[model samples]
Target chain A: MISLTDFLIVSAVLFCIGLYMIVSKHNAIQILIGIELMLNAAILNLVAFGKYDRFNNGGQMFALFAIVLAAATTAVALAIILNVYKQYKTIDPGKIDKLKD
Target chain B: MNLAQMLFYVMSFIALASAVFVAATKNLVRSIFMFFITLFALAGLYVLALADFVAVTQIVIYVGGILVLILFAFMLSGRETLNAMALQQKQFISIGKLPAFLLAALFLIVLLNMIIKVDANNLEWVKKSIESKNDIPVNAAMTEDIGVGLMTRYLLPFEAISILLMLALVGAAHLSRKGRGA
Candidate 1:
């Protein structure tokens, strides 16, 4: 009998790990990976809650949209990272301090 | 526990572990591999959650499309030394060690408390709704219902998302082609 608490706890752990990764990693691509992880955690929670949504399947549908959006975001982000790499030789985000406010 | 519960636990563990590895690994290609594993596990979890449509979307869009794009970007980008383990100064101790852990713990506690409260109130409503429902032949009915819903209630949003996607494509092309002279 896996409880909802179990699912939520797992999601929370994943989100925290992702946040830590995004904060600590110096590479732009690594930060992108962390963002993906965070999105996955949210999707997992949506699907888990969808189990209780038998009527409209709202959670399931939301998760579908989320998956698509994530893919789209990742594609755009990666492309931007490539451009960043072109402007700066290194992918280390710390080194690309040319656009500082 | 039943087969479904066991499968859920196994898939959840795999997804969480792979996600952690995706964040932790320094090698870009290795991180991509971990990302695939994480996506696959999430797809499995979606199936387990009875979101067949979402599961397929996850597999096709995330695993099939985005991951391939990520790998392509990695290969096309001229940065070869990115896979090297580049550690920041006081990597474990500076900025992330205590604050992240504390924030995570506090968030977990607050979220759990809110969930417990909400579930207590909503559980009976959900259970009652499920109990009253006679099982429809879902396989055929679900697709039709979803199609109708998309066309009727969600039509505006659906069309809007398509437009957004198109805009994104154009924007990406424009951004990338800036200094390349078409």
Candidate 2:
């Protein structure tokens, strides 16, 4: 029997890794990758706990919605990144300080 | 050390290792490939957790749709940005990223502490579910149940998400198209 704790630990580590990627990476696409990782970690948690929700399948349903939302967010973010690159000629988030007032 | 437990460990290792690579690697294209592996491994973990439908959805939507979109964006972006080799070489552990490393490590330690403190196996609802045999069986096919639920109980969110996706698609297309000045 694979305990729930095992799954939780894996996702926690994954989430932390994603957080590190988001904070440390200067590239916009790399940050998007990190966002995806964090979302996957949350989805993993939902599915793991959903195993116990036999009656409703709530966790799985929410995971589906979450995945869709992630896709949508990624699309929007990529589009914005492209626009930013166009205006600034670089994709490094750290260097794009035009909005810094 | 049952078969499921062993398989779970294998999948978890694959997912985490690739995720670490994705985070640490300086080569953007290589990290994208590693991210593919990470997503596939996570899909396997989802199956092991008895979310068959979700696992398939993860593979289909994530691998087929989102990753391809990301690749398209990568290709469309300027070569100067894509060619990240000359910019900086990022090691797994480096002095420049010390603050990020420390923050992530601290967050992991706190999360692990909280997870360990929660006795998930002996929780009241979990024990009750076990006693009543109300948990999902190991071999249950979740696709049909999920489909039914989507049409019935989750109909609102289902419809709402479709609308949201459509809006996002339109917004992305508009944003990515050339500006009037161009």
Candidate 3:
């Protein structure tokens, strides 16, 4: 019998790791990965809590939408990253100072 | 412990360990592969949480779709970036990343504290659900229920998501395609 707390702890750890990745990683793609991780963590929380919701299944439904949105966001982000690479010839977000004026 | 509890721990371990590998590994390709394992483990966790449909969706969309997109982006980018990433294998932690490490540690501590304070086992709704036998049972078939809810209660947001997906598809294609006025 795994309590909801176990899942919450796991989700929290995952969220922190994603936050670290987003803050520390230099590459844009790595940041995108971190964002995915964070979103997954949130979705995990939703599913964990949804366990108690027997009738509506709202958590699972919301998780589905979240997953779809994550996919869409990832697609758009990667495309943007590709263009950034093409323009700058580097994916290191730190060096892209074109608009830093 | 029971089978579900054991499996739950195993899946969480796999998910966390691989996620750490994905975060710490210097090799971009290896990290991506680790991410694949992470997503699969998360799907397993979802299954343990009694979300069969969501678990399947996790695998199909995350492992099948997103990972492939990431790999394609990696390939299309260039070799030089990979070389740059490979060269940074000397130190996992440095002064430059100290702030990020601190922030993550603080967040983890706060979240753990909150979760511990909440003590989920004694929650009012959980107790009520248990008393009424309204909680979702293990190995329940969620697909039919989910579909019915989507068509009925969640129909508007479902249609909105379809529109959003279409917009994203068009947007991504347009952004990635070469423009003439460059």
Which candidate should be chosen as best, given DockQ against the real structure? Answer: 3
User: On residues B47-111, what C-alpha lDDT tens digit does candidate 3 reach at each position?
Assistant: 98899889999999999999999998778667865665565444344647888989999999999
- Tally clashing residue pairs in candidate 3: 0
Q: Interface root mean square deviation of every model, in Å?
A: 3.2, 1.8, 1.7
- Best of the two (1, 2) by TM-score: 2
Docking level for model 1: acceptable
Chain B of model 2: TM-score?
Answer: 0.90
Q: What is the lDDT of residue A31 in candidate 3?
A: 87
Candidate 3 residue runs with Cα over 4 Å from true position:
B84-95
Structure candidate 1, residue pairs in collision: none
Model 1 C-alpha lDDT per residue in residues B104-147, reported as the tens digit of each score: 56776787787677763247755675577622222423555566
- Winner of 1 and 3 under TM-score: 3
* Residue-level lDDT tens digits of model 3 in A1-101: 78899999999999999999999987788889999999999999999999988898889999999999999999999988877766776677777888632
lDDT of 1: 0.71
Candidate 1 TM-score, true structure as reference? 0.84
Candidate 2 wrongly placed segments (more than 4 Å)? B84-95
